[model samples]
Target: MAEFLANYLPAWLAYMVAGAIHVGLIINLVAVGALVFIWLERKISGRIQDRLGPTRVGGKFGWLQTLADGLKLLTKEDLVPGGADKMLFRIAPYVSFCASIAAFLAIPFAGGDYPFIVQHVNTGVFFVLAVLGLEVFGVILAGYASASKWSLFGAMREAAQVVSYEVPLGLCAVVPVMLAGSLDLVVIGDVQQGWFTNWLIFHDPATFLIFWVYFTCATASVNRAPFDLAEAESELVAGFHTEYSGLRWSFFFMAEYGSMFSVSLLASILFLGGWNGPLPITEWLGLTAANGDIAWYIGQVLGVINVIGKAVAGVCVMMWIRWTLPRLRIDQVMATCLKYCTPLAAAFFLGAVAWQWSLPGRTFFGLLESPAELQSVSEGWSDATAAATDEDEPEASEDQTVSSEPSRKVAAAKLTGAAALQIASTNLQGGK
Candidate 1:
């Protein structure tokens, strides 16, 4: 879009205009997502507890309940404790809001030639996770700036909680990246194309286990209920935002909901088949470039719908879990991360590594052989190395590459670990 506009406008202005459009779209997504999720939460909670959640505001379902609530908040007085630091208190909510929404920049809703993403980051998974983590900073600032002991206490818990869970969260995230052999989420999604069984969650027992752990850590990381120690209203009196009110207070909730959706979307892309549906309906419908651009565009639209549906379902599960479970004490929360999630993540990671090493060709999904293109870790790195190189001369001629292939494969196999070492020693003795 910027390139097209550059023909008629200043280059900088064109880029700025394009950026503004993306920002506006993201802002709307955050706003609208918050509205829908809040309403969903009420209805879900109502259903779980056997009650009508919101039946009056927008007709039968009361869809306008959240919108009305937003208006009420807007009319309420914006409050800051007299003791609070003025500047930090004012900016903290926006900080959280910005960080949460920034994660969406790299989250692709659809892929192929025209992916629906504001930024196609190479290390997209890492980038999204890292940016999402930054939301804690905003909470910390709000807590400290408020000059309330309860707020500070809440902030401390959040800091400890988020930092601890990030370990397991990262580990769980890596399992899919490892399986897919790329940090680029589009590539990761592409690798899972074909059948429902091809999804990373079904790749192996290890991956299957880690997906749950990932979901748990994601829940805790976002400060959702059952692990919402940072916002234990019953104990800490509204926690980090104790002194905040009105629309500024609403920003915190907006950030929280937006973060929830972001993590859910990340989970969808990482473990589910992403834009690919269980049945390859698009492919089955002949929605491919072979037909025409219109056909291909329709396929992408289907993909977008597939991914969004998965993400929304993930959000609903979160809402269900939130209302179903009791909030854990801070100690229990920390133990869940350190004593359980982290070790399981580590074990599964090792299992996935061993499984990939020993049975690279096997899959539980089809009980069938993997495709020929499934590369070993060392081969992946070799490809990466070749791509990264910009030497005066080409690194390897075609003949040299062909001749070295078997030896390279052998060497790569030996790079696995202790078993590989023992095998190499046995091979050396046999050769001698």
Candidate 2:
């Protein structure tokens, strides 16, 4: 994009223009997406409990209700507790909000050679997790600055919960990265482009299991219901934001919703094939870069929709889980993380390693050939080598065919040691 602009404008101006576009798009997506999700959550919860929600406020579906609430918040006076530390109290929410928004900088909304991302950080996963974790520091500051016992307790719970869940969360996240061979989300999504079964979640029994654990930890990490001990309404009176109100309070909620979507986006990119749809309709229709820029443009548009749809589905599931399940005690929450999620994530991680080792080319739980049905190439290499005589021998190609590349590795296991050594010795003598 910058290059295109640079041809018509100054280099610096083109870069500035590119940056502004990214910033604008992300800010709007975060801000507007939160509004939509808030309204959607209310409707979902209402439906679950058998009632109408927010129908009178806007139009048919109460679409404008969240905007109305935003306006109300904007009109309200911002307050700081007299006993609180004014500096941190004033700044904490912005700190959290900024961290939440910054996470999207590394997150790609679509995937391809030129992905829709703000920054293509090499360690994209690492960068996102680190940025997301910084959000709790703001909550900690909010809790401490509020000078209320409830706020303090909420902040401490948040700190402990985030720290604890991060362990299993990181473990589960690593399973996909291990499979994808790159931390770049673009690469991860691209790896699963061919079919739904190629998605990392279905790569093996272990990866399939690991996806669930990841989602469980992510829900807890994001402080969604059943695990939202940080802001337990009955116990903490609004928790870390207890002493907050008005626009500032809204910022904290915005941050929460943003993080919710960010984590969901991350999960989609990792395990659900990011921008790739279940059926590969785009591929089948020949909508790819090779077909021309017009086709590529259409494909990217479809990709954007696929990505947003998957993310929205994930968020709705979270809302469903929130309303359906009763909240757990703090002890139970900690126990759930420690006793179940962590060990299961670790076990799945190990299982993926073993599966990759044993059935190197297998996919879709071994229903298809591992390494994408390369048996013919391996067999052909072995037959040609085995058929070679003591004289007039072909040059050795086993090492090249059966080296560590996953697609080329099946031949190594098939060739006997004596046969391989004989071929190697023949090549050494001939030097042809």
Candidate 3:
């Protein structure tokens, strides 16, 4: 018992502790970032309207306004409508929140040899995109459960808006995945090393334009104003969430802001250089250690700063747009997404493809190297050397080199990884 406990307990306990830490950190990020963004939004919106937003709550910036709001929501009575579907109504906000939180699972907060991701999935791009779509289900259920005509209308509108906009958003997102040549976000980030011009947004003219389309679609998808006809105050009152109050209502807002940040973070990864900045400060400063001990820590710190900086910038831009732009009508919103954004994004994708084909072995702006060619050259050289070294030794006969089940499984995993890498390479070629 003592031997077993000594052998297994430490590692098991460490894993449990690490898991707890990661969950706590992620929860804090979502909760705290939401509070900060809300405060910033109020302050920015106030300035735009030439009025004071929050003054006394948390001193100079009213930073504690969200905290106060949270307390108010918590203290308020949780009410249910007489005709509402009780179970669904009660469960709706949590559903939305869960979906929003789940997408963060595969998101790399810091990218490096060992990324600061909760789960490093091979199909991370598809997984995040798929789960993000689930957020609409909660809204739909909320609208239906509210037992109000206005709420139902708002929910249906929101559902339709998200469904329609998602098409273009996916397309726009694919443009970056195509450029990066990998669904593994860490690999994508790694490929964009060096300068900002190497970022997918600047990969080509089409991608550059597609980035805007992605941003617009992402904003609309998250039900931000201008595209927020679902919650049009004059038209639908409080929209799908009309029946919600107190903590329940607050949860919906939290989910919204959380998703807004998630999409922005996604945008930062897909278009920007993710955790990598234009300057390779970590590399230039030699923050990495020879044994990859100290360097990894410094790299993670820098990466976190880089990704957060980009995400905050994205949020600020969204707030600015919200304050500056007038709301688009539902019809106009549909037209902008389908008729304008989709077609434009598609055309840019093709243009980028043509540009890449026209200019092989060349950088986008003559400042950075083509990541594809660089990888290919490096891998080819390494493989050649390995093959040459192997040739000097006697080769094992086919009969002598038998593969076991575990070995076969290992081989299969390698093959799958290779296939994914191959597909990524092909997609990058096409994207160019």
Candidate 4:
């Protein structure tokens, strides 16, 4: 669409328009997703506690309860403490919300010849983790600027908890990158395209252990229960955002839900098969990139749905954990990360490396072979090797040559393009 617009409009204008559209879509996703999750949390928590939740707001299920709450918040007063640093306090929510939204730029919703990503960064995993870590800064700023002891304490706890958890989180995420041999998330997800056994979580015994570690750290990283010490309402009276109200408080909630969905989607790409389903239904039905453009588009749409479904399922599990388990103390949270998650992630990382080295091309308990397609696509060396093989092959009959030429040319073009991309990515990384 942007390309089409470039024909009629200036290139810069077309790009700006496309970028704005993408931004709007992502913003709506975060806003609407927060609304939905808020309703779900209330309903789910109510059921867990054997009570009805929000029956009066929007009919039987109270579907419009979030909208009602939003209206109420909008009408509430926006107050700044008399002693507060007004500028910092005012800007903090936007900082948090913007940081959460920025992480989605590198996140791909679907994969194909053209993936559904905003920016498509090469080091997507690292970029996301780094951006997510910055969210705590907003909390710290908000707490310190508010001039409240409880808020200051909450901010300090959040800073400590998030910083500590990132260690294990990075370690756990690296296991998949090691197995895939690429830092590009699209390539990582593409490598897992097949049955459920192809998912990184099931690739080996070590990865299975690492997946759990990754989830634990992910939960803590996002400040969810039972690791939500930053917002221990019973103890700290609303924690870091205690003084925040109205739309500003809503921004914090939006940021939280956005981070939740972001981490869940990251998990899907890292440990699950990503946009690919457990079965090869799309492949069987001929709805693949190899088909036609329309077929490819349809396949991509389904891929989006598949990826979103998996992400939503992950969020639901987090909600279940929140309602079912008691919130851990700040001490317990730190101990869980440093003593348990970190060491376990480190051991699992080593085990995964050894397993990959020893087994080579094995997956799923050695019952299936690991796909070499992603490696072949991302490595410039493979293109050189393929060219050499083609040159060394015996001459074929005219009829045979004619029939195979198109496919060979297409393959060569794709390999050359991928190799070029790989080189550019390497240069960019080195420059950084």
lDDT of each: 0.81, 0.80, 0.76, 0.81
Assess the local accuracy of residue 253 in candidate 3 as a C-alpha lDDT between 0 and 100.
84
Model 4 agreement with the true structure over 1-432: per-residue lDDT tens digits: 589789998999999999899999999989999999899889888888898888888788998999999999999999999999999999999999999999898999987658999888977888898899889988999989999988987887787778777877887878777666566788778888877888888888999989989998999999999988788898889899999999999999999999999999999999998999998778988998788888888888988999989999999889889999999977678778777887898789778766655665667556467666533322322333234454532222221222223333433443354344434434643664
Candidate 2 positional error at 304, Å: 1.2
CA lDDT for candidate 3: 0.76
- lDDT of candidate 1 at residue 426, scale 0 to 100: 41
Lowest summed-lDDT stretch of 10 residues in model 1? 395-404
Q: Which residue segments of model 4 deviate by more than 4 Å?
A: 374-432
**Per-candidate RMSD vs. true structure?**
10.7, 13.6, 10.1, 10.9
lDDT of 3 at 412: 41
Clashing pairs in 1: none
lDDT string, candidate 1, 1-432, tens digits: 688789999999999998999889888988999999999999999999999899999899999999999999999998888999999999999999999999999998888766778888987888898899899999999999999988987887787777677777877887777776667788778767777777888878898999999999999999999989888999999999999999989999999999999999999899998998998788889997789989998998888889888988999999999889899977688778777987898799778766765666566675555433333432443444456453532422231233224333432332233233334434643664
| Model 2 residue-pair collision total | 3
TM-score of 3: 0.83
- Please identify model 1 stretches exceeding 4 Å from their true place: 4-10, 371-432
Give the per-residue lDDT digits (tens) of candidate 3, residues 146-183. 99988887886777678777767766776655555456
